[model samples]
Target: MAATPHPAHRFLTMKAAGVTLAALVIILFAGLRFVHLEADFPPGVSGSGDLYTDEGAYSSAAVRWVTTGQWRLEGDFNPAVNLPVYPLIQAVTFKALGLSLGHARLTSVILYLLLMAAVWALARRWAGPVTALIALLVMAVNFNAFAFSRLALLEVPMTLFVVLGLLAAARGGATGTVLAAAAFLLALLTKTAAGFALPVILLVLLWRPEPLTRRLAQAGLFCALTGLGLLAYYFVLVRGHLPDYQTYFMTNVLLRTQGGLWDLGRALVRIIWYGRQFDPVLYPLALLGAAGVLVVGGKLRRHPLFWISVVWIAAYLATLATQNYAPARFYLVLAAPVGLLLGLMIEHLARSGRRGAAGLLAGVVILALAVSGGRAVDYLRHPQYSWASMMRELHGLVRQDGRENPVILGHFANSLSLGTGLLSLNDHYTWKSSLPARLERYRPDYYVTLGGIEAPIRSVLERYGTVEPVRTWDVFHNYYTGEPVALYRLTRKSPLEASRP
Candidate 1:
């Protein structure tokens, strides 16, 4: 009964709707991450185990930088290790926000929000409005990704840099190349594991439909800049600490290489187990999407997004399987790729005039929201174990003098030092031949025996002195996943100088 609307009017209406929908998606994603943002944060030094005082170590440096105005990695309450960019960010945040674990975690929560937008923007370019929204929703609904965003950890920042770098590199210009190169360099600086995805950035450049010389030029420039940045970082941070760096390599890298062909099988099983992070619905859909891409991706097969996803999944999964393994938080980087792959399938379905595409997408979103909602509720009810209060209490127990805060010596001693502002040292990674001497040299007023691990420390404590923990607390990597870590306090050390070799 009404005249047909003008074509421009229809286009305007659709554009407005798309923008509004995107706004809602981003708002929802950010809101979820911010809720209970400080849940069990600063999880205390070694709160997550394996010297997992990751949050403490980083926060301590930032606090020192801001309070003492010295970037002292060797001074009291300092760990011998260092990471520059992330701690610097923390210092800035603490400088402004008055320095609490909550303020520090704010950085990750913000980065988490930016990461969602970046994923959506990247997908919008690769697929379209519908596929972009689909990808963002899928990523947002991931509970592991959601859960980890509440920590003051480097992984979220590294992953954000990776996605942003790829997005910039895909834009196809000299400016984009430079921005992408910088972002990639920042990722590497955040953690060396980021090197696993370096080749993907180069692929983005070389795969461009441009003259070979131009592509080569851009790729060469990107490599040169990134390499220079890494060198400068090393020159500044590691050149003075060569021995410590070597120890880090031996423990972090060589120890990881201890297995053989049999490990590949174990790695497969481990990765499958880790895939539970994607949950009952999203992961299976991703597998289906991955298979679907090969059969029906059409133009997507030639797209950089497809190749990037393939390369990242292969490289990260391979490395995760082989060496440098840790908790499933390592899988956070894959969230975007997995979502994009699923979006690819949805895009193909929609293009084929399948109206169920809308229904299918809605189903995925609703299911993801429902599942993530359950996780959120569970998280709030029973928070993760925090060792912060316990560490402070133990330090207080044996401190006979207030003029000097008692030193804490054990695994992740840096964290104890940082979190509690007490002198702390642990030769946790030093060659075993020198361990006894290393243990005797510190003469810590107190010693902490970690769970089932740190036999060397326990042996030294036994051989030398009266070791006791006033009390023990139950803790895990996250919400009780692994064995409980034991906390011991060395209440008395009898003539450690006599026990030394």
Candidate 2:
């Protein structure tokens, strides 16, 4: 049996609890960040030295922007690959903190912190203080958020803007509407994929308590203006850049969404499994809450917060399934909604006076925090910093070959280019059939292959030079693989012999 407290005292206690939860979130994320600051990669790649692929491209772009005062891709002005918001943020960080991987990643860390703060605000708005606290706790320790926050990538920032817009929409006023419009525009500038959120936002506005016709008209005007502004901005920026606006829009948007049906199915499965992986107890509870609204659409169905989460999950899933590729970080958009749903579900259960069920939920939360926190601690402090040595050796080998600014080609060309200060080309994507011709055209001095070379690619290289080991690599520290990395220099062959292949 529990004792009921005086109303005044209970209010004070709740306020104290909220403050404590806020502090805990700050300490947890900030501490986790610094604890794993040297997690696996070296300083130049990511602050925590993780082998996140996009970090290299984004950071390299930032370095170029900061030093040369031009936003370029692969040493040329190309706006096709990424939007300007993230690179612009990184460039500002470079100016203030000096150009280093740690400083570049610091920008992401800060954005993630802001993201957590936004989650707390949105959760508090939908649910009470207790759910808000739990939501913050879950986000603070969840491995994906912890890990991705330390990398210089755009996912966290994109999610941040999206959540901010959602929060503004939830507030429901003239000011909130204007803020939502601005936030959504910023979200699009961060990542064009954010356009997927438009459907969700439209759904939200329709569900608003205001009269249907007025709300729809207002939402329509606002969205139209926002889209026009974004187009005008992009039009101004694409001037004199390679892969201009039309080409970028067609390839990244139109072409990218055409296939990958299998990928969509797989992503749906992975999102469910990984959602559980993040928090076994809470995610299932979230699903239960979702089902509750579907089955018992009383007030919950009409609630603005409920519909917001519903739309977010549906829109993001559809977007993920339709996209050509799905990375783990792309699933991050689901985290906040899951948190809110969990809180709502738990609140619903508690209100039904199922004390036993509520007790079990508490147990699950405790178990999840302890289990997830323990795993994160082990991964962070582990002494698998050997990847730094491997990259250093590879950099040395490139320098030893007496080829400054040499054209180098590999699968992870962006990471290698960033690490080695040499021209690196990625063969992972795009016209594989033309790889040989491109190699001849680029005329790379060194070819790097992870694990070993395949026959087709090897045959092309063998036409020009024989394979020789640069150095034997024992392990790759990032993915924790023991595969040996091989580097080969394409010694010149006679023009006739080279043409024989």
Misplaced by over 4 Å in model 1 are 1-26, 41-52, 57-60, 63-83, 258-273, 324-326, 381-403, 412-419, 427-442, 450-455, 462-465, 476-501
Per-model lDDT: 0.66, 0.65
Backbone clashes in model 2: 1
Kindly report which residue pairs in candidate 2 clash with one another: 41-49
State residue 491's C-alpha deviation in candidate 1, in Å.
5.9
TM-score, per-candidate, Cα-based: 0.81, 0.81
What is candidate 2's CA lDDT for residue 93?
85
> Local error of candidate 1 at 183, Å?
2.0
- Residue 165, candidate 1: C-alpha displacement in angstroms: 1.8
Instruction: Specify the highest-TM-score model's number.
Output: 1
Error of 2 at 197 (Å): 1.8
